[model samples]
Target: MSRSFIIDGSIIYTNYSQIIGQSKFEELLREFVDILKEKQSPLLNALNAFKVNSDYDVHRFTEYLHLLTMRNIKEIGNIIYYVNPKDLERFIEAFYTFWRSKHRFMVRNEKYAEDYNRRASIEYTVTMIGDQFKATIKNLYRELMMNVSNTFPTVMRQLPSGAQVMFLIQEPNGEKYRKNEWVTKIPTVWGAIFDPPAIFYTKSNKRRGILPVVEKDILSEIALDPNEWYRFAIYVGDLLMYNFVHVEYLAHGAGLANLFELATPKDLESREPDGILIFGLPADKIPGYNEKWRNGVIFKEEDGYTGVIPAFDENDYFGYMKKTTLTIHNLIKIDRGKLPIHGSMARITLKSGKSVVAMFVGDSGAGKSETLDALNRLEEVAQIDTIIDDMGSLDIIDGHVVAFGTETGAFVRLDDLPPGFAYSTMDRSIFMNPDQINARVIVPFNNYNEVITPTHIDFFLYANNYTEVHNDEERIVFFKNPNEALKVFSEGKRMSKGTTSETGLTNSYFANPFGAIQRKEEHHRIAEHFIKKMFETGVKIGEIRTMLGVQGYEKEGTMLAARALLKVIEQI
Candidate 1:
């Protein structure tokens, strides 16, 4: 073929322009016809082997594909539509599944990385002179539109100021989507493609600064096509965070935006954000920022809010976006004399009309969420209202420690839950990497009002997922002293169950590496003040050994912990 593209799994990428003229575009299609004649592709090989249609052989396959556009494919990138393949939908789906399982797409070009994924697929004009071919193409497109619509790869929101923050969701799937209440049962791949397997983070954020240089490299590109992007707003706990996302990472931004409350048009008009993120710049192309930014870094913006730019656009992970937003929110909370916790909080109401707000603090793989999930499953429980699933802040309201949630949704691990947990909520979940390690499911657990509103804390416990609970009494234990409680929480200890790159015993400062690690001394003072206040105010503090990290106790330990919690609640 005169025109070439690097076939990366399901993607056909090329740095050079494919559109030369009508004649050239037709020639390219002719080349594809030749390639199809050999029945080289697995889908074609199987089709021929089965002899699905004896009337037409591989050489006569050109009739199936109508020449799309006679222009260069560079404007929006290359795409292939299956059209109305009828029963072949499964076979075609299998074709894509086979390629996706093989390897991730590689963009091969050493320079000029395309600042986009999820290449836009549009309706082809079918400029060929032949009426038969044109009619076939038109009918296929009509049939295609009836089933799906054009959706972007990145989830984007362009601000009125033209600034944007876009979240490039990693390996999006059609199993579920995030809508109002994470609407369920819609498995439409309207705007997503099968991305390569996601890898564990080799690098994590480790640096912070007072003020960072405002970047323009990405801004310049967005200026070239200002109308292309979409827009969004967020309230991270109590702080307003505005984002202007460039169009390059469109379609998938909703997954990221759903983590927080979507600001109303009224909210956008009345308030200024405490933090702002301008996304879409390629990390490799930008200059003067710290080299460690490639690793991950957060800095104060000139406008007084925390600023975060994705470290790398190429082969990036959603963690960079998720954590950066959390870091900024946590930092603001820290500055405001509030305590940000890397934990989970739930208000559990027993069948006897007794309710208690239980707060579990620990790092990843610590069973903070698993124990709460277990409590929800108990028959004696009325309902467990989850105030926070991962990150939240502690504040003194009316002389009592009150917990506020950070995220509107829950990004949960599939392997940790009971067998049917994820599948049962398939209607309102975004399933990611379900076939791989650290497979996760993101679901909207509650609404914005519930997240931002404060809930009083009754039982403050450090999750001890690594420890073995030999008996019911051992499942939950009080620290006996405020200092002892402080000492335990300060250590931030947990046993790694492979949620991250760590193994064995691990300790993070106050179980939060996002913000406190950057301002340890200040956070230490805050933690001490809060710990003593909780003790003084009659809030019971202790540890619950869910043993989620125990080699064989993953499921059983959480149940034991839940039952013990129930017993404790009943006695009170």
Candidate 2:
């Protein structure tokens, strides 16, 4: 029994002999169909058995089908009886051309339509969701994932230091986390996903490392929504930093929003962001975590963009918030080529009616803020206006050294602050882990205007609280040469007082890793040039040994530093 087959809606078979008066091309087609039928059943069964599951499988199957069809035609041409070779050849060529063209068209059209529909559906969904939650509470992730525009709903604000920032958020797909369980892996772009770090109650405790991101995995990580997240535009020194982040809870975002003076949608309309920081935090422990995530925070710089992703954990009261903010600041520092110093700054007025803007550079527990707070309490000091307490920028503008504040609020260590300080700002502050040793509060200590304005730096001093001063009158050592000033600034040496995991003496480039370390050569050049310029302008450069890093000398050091600072202000 001969098999039957259909070709272009015509029935053909090996045994059927209706060849009389039929065109040679028709005869050829009948032969081809008969041969195809002989092999079709096995091919169909094989294809069915190897079901098209993934895109790769579908592609392989399509290629196999095309090859099989062409082979069958050729086989039939050789076996057909009484068929003219020239006629057969022409028919084969025409059929091949048609098949190829049809296949190409179908593949191209299908892919194009699929992409277009997917995009359109996302846009339509975004519009619907945005409209639904316009006035009420809404999940930003939902709105963004469905959004048609590449740009998300953004917010911008001017930092205290006159830098404007914009935040761009990428929303993750809703089903991504649901499908993977709530414990989805932290996106690789935002540092390595790892188990919790070893907690040490001892001094000199090494914090967890931050892993560099695998650049190739960034997009995939961004698309996965492990949890709800928020993006922030906070002014860090001279750059406007954008932070795309997910915290374990909404309260963290709310707290930071209040602390950073987050801009509204209306504010974003007028400003452009300077740099970006993409970060992700998982609520629960990540299962089967990548080993790279345990390495630590990763800093990436590409074309006009700079960013970092720190390792994240929900209960990490220190590194999670602290390191993430530092990463963002460092990114901005790299982007803007500004000097980010770990310090406190203020505009002080002396009893003699002399006003000077002074910056006290130091590490944590080095009494930078405490010294300034003490200066504010001095009777000889007329008024002391706080500019920035944690991090700030130093820039050379028009041949004059100037300082700018980063945050409007201060993330001060509660243990070091005056007894009533945290309580005084409780209404507008967010206290994190108050029961812990390194308890922190974000309070709006200064207005936005006070932070952004470029203030001429009249004095630059290192808050050397670790150094013991036997002679209190000779506590302040003035540098005669700019090189000497640069040496001290570059050393950034300070004693650890348990504000962080570091114990004993430690040093960072200019007491800052955020800006100075990222751009060492640039910062050094700027420092040299600015120091000389400041010296020529008669701006005082010196180090004041407050000894505040010592246990029993906190009050004594503050008093001595305040009195010396008052004298310096009077002279200026």
Where is model 2 more than 4 Å wrong at Cα?
1-221, 224-227, 247-249, 267-272, 282-296, 304-315
Off by over 4 Å in 1: 1-64, 67-230, 244-252, 309-315
Q: How does each model score on lDDT? A: 0.58, 0.52
Q: Quote the lDDT for 154 in model 2.
A: 63
Tens-digit lDDT track of model 2 for 1-572? 11111111122222112221225324433444444447553322322423445212334433333333334433433443223334333433333332222101000000111255664554444333323322111222222222212233466321111001111222222212232232223211111111111011211122443324333323223332533445555555545555555533333343355445554333333555555554444412332245555423443434324343333442334334445566556545544666666788888887777888888888677788888888888888888889877777777778777777777777677777688887777655656566667766656677777787888887789878778877756778899899899999899888877765568888877876554665678778767877788899878899988788776886778778788867765655
lDDT of 1 by residue, 1-572 (tens): 22112121222212112222224334434454345557655444433422435322332232222232222222222343233233334433443233223222111111111233313212111111122222332333333222323322263322111001112221212222222121122111122122112222212212222223232333222221333333445677888765544444332344455466765433433555677554554565344456656534455544444344553443133444566678788888888888999899999999899999999998877898889888999999999999899999999988889899989888777788887987787665555556656666667788888888988888999999888868999999998888899888888889977766577998877888878877788998999999889988989899999999888998899989999999998998
What's the true lDDT of residue 534 in model 1? Answer: 93
RMSD to native for every prediction? 13.5, 23.4
Best by lDDT: 1
* Candidate 1 TM-score, C-alpha based: 0.67
Q: How do all models score by TM-score?
A: 0.67, 0.59
